[model samples]
Target: MAMEGYRGFLALLVSALLVGFLSVIFTLIWVLHYREGLGWDGTALEFNWHPVLVVTGFVFILGIAIIVYRLPWTWKCSKLLMKSIHAGLNTVAAILAIISLVAVFDFHNAKKIPNMYSLHSWVGLTAVILYILQLLLGFFVFLLPWAPLSLRALLMPIHVYSGLFIFGTVIATVLMGLTEKLIFALPSYSSLPPEGVFTNTLGLLILVFGALIFWIVTRPQWKRPKEPNSVLLQPNGGAPEGVESSMAMNFGNVDKSDSELNNEAAARKRNITLDEAGQRSTM
Candidate 1:
């Protein structure tokens, strides 16, 4: 695959970070300023925690998790370490999302409001549940030592696809939630009050951030470069089976000629035979 230069990738990455930052910051401003601050008191203030955590933890951090593999600074790190970082971020996102759900449920029950009655609620809950499953499967399939390389390879595509799908689902669910909240809270949402406009801007920022992440991840040239493992295997004269699978990402990089391995094996056998014969004769 033709690897693209870092200049373009860096530019897009910077833009993504900026947009994600703005989205989270805007969410905080909306809740703290316009919505009269946050709390855990089974009030609307507590419900405010939902949007704040979702944007900061779930949306922004999750976006970071998805594109982490493409980060140039992390290139020198072991693939296992990189995978850990990716999974760690996702786990944090899931935790925050669960907390946000608790906040919403508590506030609703306190206010005697019905729950799970809207499409936004349904989709959001479903997405979060699937996200959790994805995290667990990813840990077992990619991080665990027992899983064979072939299994990892087979599941990698599904893992990646599900992760992206969950991300997109959450984005859609968030947009729906925003619109729903505005319709009820603003009542005159058609007139576009300051709160409505500000919240809408937050939604737009989220869209931009999501787009940048997907673009970065889907670009073939932006994939993390494979390390050259053949150099390390040269001393052995032949590479171990599944050495390529161990690095996994560089399935094509580890290699040695069959003839070289055969020659080395024969020479080593002859040396052992000669040493044994000389020892016996001396005795």
Candidate 2:
């Protein structure tokens, strides 16, 4: 059977992406129109780049990178191609995040403001560092040709958990950063000015988007379907028999019997043998 609820999951993914993009756009407008605009020179306006780029890259682009493999259409593509796209998008997000940090630092230094003073800064920096480390480990373990299969298998769970954790952490950091910005920039954020209202709405949208993305990624039934020609096959150039049936056994949906496994294996072996024999006869 096909993956259950995949259509609903896909719809949610699209909705989350739309909400996320709107939030980013709203943030830019808030910063540019109501507050200082973006710049690179040491000014308050220059610091606007920090929030804009962080929301765009760290939240939106990074989120897409994390979920690219879950896209239904991507199942038809080679696993290697998907992996390359995932890595490349993450690299771009990292670069944007780094530039955003530079913008914040430059503005603070120019204004003689202390850096890393707020809880937002502390958590945000930690999240960025952890994210970069995760990316590096994922690249070396999964994408590179040198890593052993055993090592990849061992690290796979850790990598997945840590990635989800970091994604949540980044969203939390963004919310904290928004709160900090509103407190500092708005004279009466409690009373709710237009800017404050807009900012708060943007934060809510971001929170919803992040949550939806996480839900989509975590749902096992929403996982991409395994293609017949997947690159995940054994080096001997054949898909492993009984993998799916074995999984069904755990759910009591399929009977577990040695006879069944043996028969399946025997059939696969017989097919291979017949194919080889036919090839020889043709030659």
Candidate 3:
């Protein structure tokens, strides 16, 4: 578990660093674009929100990645931890989704989008705030010992909602980024790895990589032991064997055969006689 947490932490930290580094490069590119104004008028690149959103998105991604991947405890003892991690990731993801969606709209009206750059800036700032909150919550979870397993279950709804939102937002952001004039102002497309490097299309790369990472980390734990004892039923108490098996058997109220009833009666009678005989001998 420690190893897993470390790996997750590293992944998030590295990804965040990359995003920060890239933000600088992109900002420089935008500045140069503003000065050149090849196709555009010499507008002072008034507060475009793209940079902010990009940085925000990166922060969100990093926070969610860390929360989802880190943490040593499982559903057994540290349910609260699991829930907190899940909630933290989902919360970051939710903010990211909202910003991404808004980015889509902003990019659509790139020319008329009031304070487009500012929008990006605010989104980044919000992302930073949300990430900090998530980190705080994560620390709380880490220190906790026992927690209800249901806590993790409780976060599923939010997680699902946040995840769906991300899908839509990513798609929208990619599309708008690709088609808008803002992209044209940036450095030559060839300079980047591909034409759609900064477009919504790049989300596909993120999706694919995210999926791969999840698979790698959660692929499989050690093969489960074949024996029942090895199952190691959690502390959460469940039904007894008789009740569980009885429900499974689904035995309707059917009458027993006369012979079977007679045999059972005979067995009881024989046990009584044996007890009586033993008692008499002892006397």
Candidate 4:
């Protein structure tokens, strides 16, 4: 039953990821074929890079980064490797997102258009800033060797919640930006032009993608399996192994002699027998 549930969840996750990838591809096609192609020469077409990169990075890549830990295929790998992958993906996403912002700003400056004057701009900038901060905090606390274990434990929940909040903010900002672009670029947006309809559909797909990513990340059952003897190693060294490593980590690890373990097992068996006997008597 558990395997069936996991398979079902995996199917849903893959479907959502595919929808997001397609939506991003369609958005890029719409921009290049219908609106403007991408460039970096400070032309109006240069601005096209902003939306494309933002969608790819903030929406698509970030979604994958958020759910990387939840992927069942990574269960066999060490947690350290998974963490490295997660951080690496997020770093790439952040770099792409920053370049997208730079593209927008460069375009605006070249056109002599005022920047940060729109609600979309405000929300998007805020989201990016918060995302960068989240990344820095996560790196220093979780990845670096400076922080203690207690601090890492304390900050983990906050980091998770803020990450999800930033994801939602990015999606909301993208939706707003899409609406603003349609209103400005399409004269008949109020009358629902074809481009407007297509853009709205794309926006809906992005929203659904974000929702699915959030759902997968938050579901407790979908979390990655922690190894019983997993050890959080420092950057230098000092990692134990086997049962000793488990005890050192203190992740529900208890130190028990063989006799103690045997006694506990016998007690559990006796309790099960007593419970069965009581049930049979009641029947």
| lDDT of the candidates, in the order given | 0.88, 0.85, 0.45, 0.85
RMSD of each: 9.1, 11.2, 10.6, 11.8
The sequence of per-residue lDDT tens digits that candidate 2 reaches over residues 2-40 is 557767976898798899899889988988898867777
Clash pairs, model 3 backbone:
47-117, 47-118, 48-116, 48-117, 49-116, 49-117, 49-120, 52-120, 174-200
TM-score of 3: 0.40
Model 2, position 162: C-alpha lDDT score = 91
Error of 1 at 73 (Å): 1.5
Worst 10 residues of 1 by lDDT: 230-239
Q: Please give, for residues 1-283, the per-residue lDDT of candidate 1 as tens digits.
A: 3347788998999999999999999999999998899999999999999999999888999999999999878888888899899989999999999999999999999999999999999999999999999999998878777876556656777899999999999999999999998888788789888999999999999999999999999998888877665222322345544465676645434343556778899999999999999999999
Residues 127-242 of candidate 4 have per-residue lDDT tens digits of 99999999999888887778976567668888999999999999999999999988888898999878888899999999989889988887888877658765444323344335
Model 1 regions lying over 4 Å from their true place:
1-3, 230-283
How do all the candidates rank in terms of lDDT, highest first? 1, 2, 4, 3
Q: Give the TM-score of candidate 1.
A: 0.81
Once fitted onto the true fold, the runs of candidate 4 whose alpha carbons sit more than 4 angstroms away are 1-4, 231-283
Candidate 4: which pairs clash?
none
Displacement of the residue 217 alpha carbon in candidate 4, Å: 1.1
Model 3, range 78-186, lDDT digits (tens) per residue?
4444556565555565565455445545445565654436443454345445544544444443325343434433443444444434433443343344345445554
